[model samples]
Target: MKAVLVGILVGLATASPVSLHRDPWDPTIKLPSPTQQLVWGDVNVLHTTDIHGWISGHSKDVYPEKSWSGNFGDFYSFVTHMRQKAMTKKSDLLLIDTGDRRIGHGLTDHIFDPKKANGQDA
Candidate 1:
């Protein structure tokens, strides 16, 4: 466990020094990408909150939105890599997701009660 913790600490140390910048064409928009080595520390944690069923990731088909898009698959890969690193040094790395779930999405939102003849378009 200590070994794992140490690994996690090392990975954490190398993470989080991402560059946050806006597109020159669109200053209102922002993009986040790791650009340098992160500061090391004794403890580290990763938490995700207020995500409304967007695990599928940002859309690339849509214009101007693909710049910062990364899907659940990518996220899993990152976590797995971190886990491997953590296992090496027996360090600790906790990931928490406070999901809002899928409620306002298109398919669910379009669900109409067609069972009754009450008439609502799905």
Candidate 2:
């Protein structure tokens, strides 16, 4: 039992940083581009959904939640840097976001000041 636990911990510790999604480095792997004449057996796709407006990440210093402490600003910076690096390496990469633009959180719910309640800019 102890050996199994240790193995699991070691395995997790060395996992790749990239998720199962499109490896931002795939295009630079020297593989031929997909062609009409050739068929591929397997492909990988990654999806992130139901993000809501949690772009700023949970502010509360809670466990697990705090693990994803990256806010939208951090995400934006990360994507920008990744895209630039991919471009330099001639890699094909795509970044996408799902729907649900608004209607949550104090910022959205408190569109108008509760004291005013007249749609006036506070």
Candidate 3:
């Protein structure tokens, strides 16, 4: 119970709810300003899961979906920045990825295989 609460708090601190500019192509996309100030604790952890080969990002510019459409590289940059923030604050932050990277886009799920059915498995 406490862990869940901590997780929520940690997430809120690290991200602005809608963190990145997911779709720069869309002209009408409205991004919200980050209002939450980070309150780093002694220990913190960030976990990402259920990616399903979406390590790239959302290609189509759809509502709500576009909010989290940044690629893994973007995510890495975000985490790196946050980690730096934690270091300045003298807090410990850990990043954990529990995603099952399978079941994804054509480029990843298909592409090179002769069958094009089973991709590079874990």
Candidate 4:
């Protein structure tokens, strides 16, 4: 009975590695699109805050993480597209970043000198 249990444990341990063959970085995965059409008014405001320098975005293939995919470039493209739409419609589109642009992720952490605290790189 002990030998059977030992063999089962060994088999489980060996099979555990196979189950862990999932890739964290899937390049083929696309970012999700908006489900519903947005109702744009004369004055449209796009607000972004507390980014903490996470420009690369969440790459995990999980629930909330997958929902928030797309990096800074993707966001910029989206803003550009919206701006174009607003221009064609003669509407005012405002993009606002309410502070907190530094000191959180790897992109904004430890990259500057000790003198720079608030992303002031001279």
In candidate 4, list every pair of residues with a backbone clash: none
Tens digit of lDDT per residue, candidate 1, span 1-122? 99999999999998988656444346675655889865434455677665544568776644446654766788789889877777666778888865432333322333633233233332
Against the hidden true structure, what lDDT does model 2 obtain? Answer: 0.57
Q: Tell me the tens digit of each residue's lDDT in model 3 across 1-122.
A: 99999999998899756555455446785666889976789998888776765678887667567766878899889899989999998999999875442444333444544344345441
Q: Indicate the TM-score of model 4.
A: 0.52
Off by over 4 Å in 4: 1-37, 101-122
Instruction: Compare candidates 2 and 4 on lDDT and give the better one.
Output: 4
Model 1 ranges with Cα > 4 A deviation: 1-36, 39-42, 60-64, 101-122
RMSD of each: 20.4, 13.5, 16.4, 7.0
List, residue by residue over 10-112, the lDDT tens digit for candidate 2: 9999987864543333456465577774222233222455565567787866545665677778877877776666666666556655433232333333464
Whole-model Cα lDDT of every candidate shown, in order: 0.61, 0.57, 0.71, 0.74
Candidate number with greatest lDDT = 4
List model 4 lDDT by residue over 34-104, tens digit each.
Answer: 99998889999999877764688876777556756778999899999999999998999999877453445
**In angstroms, how far off is 116's CA in candidate 3?**
18
Q: Top TM-score: which candidate number?
A: 3
Ranking by TM-score: 3, 4, 1, 2
